[model samples]
Target: MVEIKIALVGQPNVGKSHLINSISGATLHVGNFSGVTVEKKEVEFERDGYRLKLIDLPGTYSLHPYTPEERVTKEFLLNGEYDLILNVVDSNQLQKNLTFSWQIADLNKPMVIAFNMYDEYSKRGGEIDTEKFFKLTNIRAQNVSAKENFGLEELFKKVIKTYQEQNKPRIYYSEIIEEEIENVREKIKDCRFDKRFVAIRLLEDDEDIYKIVHEKPWFVELLPQLNESKQIIKNEYDEDDLKEIFFEERLALSKGIISQVAKIAKRETLSEKIDKILIHPVLGLPIFLFVMWLLFQATFNLGAAPMDYIASVFDSISNFVGKFLPDGILKDAIINGVIPAIGAVVMFLPNILILFLGINLMEQTGYMARAAYVMDGILKRFGLQGRAFIPLVSGFGCSVPAYMAARTLKNPKDRLITMLIIGFMSCGARLPIYVLLVSAFFAPEVQGNVMFAIYIGGALVGLIVAKILRIVLFKGEPEPFVMELPKYRFPKIKALLFDLWIKTKTYLKKAGVFIALASLAVWFLSSFPRENIVKEYSLKIAHVKSEVKKEELKEEMRKKILENSYIARIGKIMEPITKPLDLSWREDVALLSGLAAKETVVSTMAVLYGGNSSNSKKLIEIIRNSLPFTAAVAMIIVVMFYSPCVAAMSTFYAEVPQWVWRIFYTIYPNVFAYFAALLAVSLIKLFS
Candidate 1:
């Protein structure tokens, strides 16, 4: 079989990933490309004796590279290795997506255009003349619903024909551009590049293109001539500005082709008149809120049973080990310390998996784009675009995944803005805190609304933080909100699950390693009081213990041993500092140390308080009842305002260059926590 290299290249979020996923019979990550941290993916498969290796490039609307993702795409297309280029264009906004198709043709490559999102056109009572699209661009156009995996037979057939059969070159630039290109060609003595591609890029004032011409041997020889011609073009109008002139010209061409050959009936739109109500600001926002609330209810509350089941499984294993193992320090460590930590994370798995499943479903159905569009007006003031909501809403499921989701954006500043704010959104890790606090503090009548308040509080905090950061640290205006609202379809459950499993399995692996080590360390500190009791007759125990019963002596020895342990010593040292936060030395040590990972707070409390504080509420109760009311409440507020783990900090450090800035980021949260607690206590005093 002749191996054919077919590249799927287009602007981001045009459903390129889904098109690849559909053709490969594999669920390639079809979410935001930046979110997935994917620069490119090459997959090999065969269809009808034609072996194909499909390369998925990062989405770019224009080849004038602004960000790393767009730059990477331009470089890949210039490589000229692919036998045929499959241009994935979103059909609803063909005007924009097709512009890149014209640019691709400028490269003089054999290409077949895969009209993605064709269903959007069909549903909206719009007609597209594929022949007209082909004729105008000098490339073949085929329809496809990438989300539904339709038109693969025609797509692959075109791919096979384009690769194996003789194909004509598709280079149709304006006569003016062609004339400039021919004049520029004369100056070159010998050049290895496809002259047309180089000439076009050079005329467009691509700095990278200029650098290449200046660096290469032949271009170096003919540099002055190319520059002179470029200067002339620059004086009249830049070549990068050529697309607009061409765009208007093509629209007129398209209108002629469309008017004659295509007709769209005004019969009821396939999607119905529901959009009239659905898109209305007053009704739409409420409807959207209801749908979002339902999704959360389904993913969280409905999935609680499975989450509880997973918890029980891990919990029982710990209990079984406690029963089966010899009654010793090691046994206790295995059961209460390591196992409980692992169980705490595993319990959330069902909820986490289900959450992403719904997100994946939203993404596949194309409602996500619509949601972004609707959110745009509100989000603009908050330093967010419609796209920003995708990661933020998804953060409710889990922040780590949500952080990864921010990568879908191609703008660097926007990506950073999204990242900084997303952490403030209430993550699932913080859900247990809400459930515990809301249940304890609020009446049952107000619990649901109280829970909603805390969630909205996080979102508001996150967006404000993003907005502030954008103005002070990150330097850039938010790009205009421009994205296609793709046609909706029923999601494939199997595909959704496959994607969700990839995400959940990664979290499980993290829980097993990081949580395991943290838990073991907590066990060591907690078990020190027990470990120090090795000597009986070796010490002066012969005096008092000689008169005491064996069991009583052993008990007394254990009590005395705990008082001298290193953890106790450390607690004493940290006592003063923790006092303001309403922490005893023991709680302080746990709080100070557990800043490495929030999950450690519970494990440390389990050992320190000598109570099985498996849940956040139980732990909070132990802390509250241990100290005075004000001090006990301080711990909760502190944790709420504290910085994320060291790992998360390192990620921030790498992302944001200023270490002092990161320090500011860290110190501010802890300070906020302290004062927020103080404020809460003072407020309670006034209310009472």
Candidate 2:
């Protein structure tokens, strides 16, 4: 079987991911591009005696790279191994998207254009003549809706056919640009890229292309011609900026070609109509808040419906296994430590899933863009732009990705400030901690509202801190925000379920592996260095005649062992720091364990508190009866404001090179968290 390597390229929000998901039988592998945080997605599958491998490059608006993601795309297209380019374009944004399409077509590779979102376009009476498009650019084009599963098969057929014929794009620019391109193309020698590509990029003064061709032997001759050609084009076009000249040339070409090959849609777009109310200055913010509140309410109330069953299942398994195993360390670890700790974390999977599902829906249906636009006004006041909302919103999912998402913001000051406060947005990993505390402390009817408030409070506090950082540290005006608002559509259930399944698999994997190991270690640390204490107590319980008194003595032995345990000793060292926050040794250990991963906070608490009759009670029940309400509030406050896990911190470190900023990022969150927790405890004491 022959393999056809295809590069999938498109601008952001052009349904590129949806196109990949719609491919039948395609297998996907996702990772970061080498030495960069930009995500790389590749799909492979057999189709009609050929194995097609597709590399989904990060979305780039143009070959003139402005962001790291765009640079990644440009670098891969220029140098990565690929047999053909599959450029995906939004059918509705023809003038803009096609301008980029023309720029990529200059690469002179075997290429195909996929006019994605044709369903939406056609509904408004728009049409594209694919045959005419081919005649105009010598590149086959298809009008496909990845959302509706339209033309995907035909699109792939064209891809394979283009590869078999080794057909490259024959796109041409204006007469002046073409003449200069030929002039520069003549001097090019021993170049890996197509001569025309090298010439055109040179005319545009692309630094990346310059770096590549400068070392060539022909560069000495090409430089003078390149400079002269650029001057000629600028003078002819009456534009000083060579880059702008080329951009306008491409834009003019796009407008000309689109007019000849496509019929414009006549209807006012539904997205524009919806935006009137959704992005309205007065109502947009409140509507966004209401939508978010409802999502959290669902995350808490709907997700809690299955918790009892999950808790019971784990209990039954523990009891059944405990009956057979001998009274030994392995049995104790499995029953009292690993099983219960994992159960405590696993039971919150529904809450995490609901939260993720809500986020995915918002993104898929395109409300997230509107939310960003609505928030831009507020973000600007804090020295951030609408683009910063993406990473900040992603922080609700996880900080590692949120930190990576910060790469989208071009300004360094905006990126750093957004990253610094992502921890305060409270990631999904911290959900279990919040849920555990809220369920234990708040009333049943108000649990969802409390959950919503926790999220809102964290976000509000994060905004305030961003303002402070901007005023004191960054001290600059934010860049103006411009973003494409994709049309709203019904989310495909299959895609939503697939995304949920991925989230579910990831959460379960962490529960079964990382959380289990952390629990075992926590159990071991808090269980041992007490053999003498245990042996001493065992003697007393053994001598007792009354069954009730024997159980009491056993409970006493458990407490004594826990108090002398290694983890407790470790917690004791932090007593002075946490004491003012109304935190005890167990809470101290839980928070400490949380530095590794937030899920471990609950697991550590489960291990610390699961002593007597734990097998018969839920972790939440035990926690509710054990800790005071004020301590729960303080723990929640601390978790909300503290430094993120090691993975997120390392990501921040990697993204940011300066040690001074890294040190500030590392130390400020914990300092903020401590004072926040202290204040919370003090306020509660005064109120009570």
Look at candidate 2 and tell me the lDDT of residue 522: 63
What is the number of backbone collisions in each predicted candidate, taken in the order shown? Answer: 6, 0
User: What value of lDDT does candidate 1 attain over all alpha carbons?
Assistant: 0.65
TM-score of each: 0.77, 0.82
Candidate 2 C-alpha lDDT tens digits along 1-688: 9999999999998989889889988888866799765558899998889999999998888898867788889999999999999999999889999899988998999999999999888988999999999998999999999989999999989999999999989888878889999999999999889989988988888999999999998899988998899889888988889889888888898989988999999765677888889988899989987886687677666766787789899999999999999987789889988787677557657666776787778878999778778877778876777768767876786675567557656656778889999999988789988888898888999999999998999999999999899889866554546676778878888888877776566445533454456556766786888779978987898898999999778767776776788877889998877888778889998887787678778877876786433442488889989998888999999999998876567567767868899899989999998888888889889998
lDDT of 1 by residue, 1-688 (tens): 7888876788766777667667754324322233333445676778888778887887777777666777777877876477788888877666666666667766666788887866766876766676765665556768888776687678888778766654534655546656777777766555555677777667666677777678666766566766676566545555445445545544554455456534553444433355666657678777777777887787667777886787788888988778889967678678877787676556556655666776677678777766776777888887777767766776676554455556455566677678666556655555554454455555789878867766786677778877887778866655765676554566766557666666665555644465456555655664476544646522545555555565456545544444456556777897886666556776675665454456556555555665455565576576546666565456556655566554344344444555666677767666666677777777766787
- Candidate models: Cα lDDT each: 0.65, 0.83
In terms of lDDT, the poorest run of 10 residues in model 1 is 26-35
Error of 1 at 55 (Å): 1.4
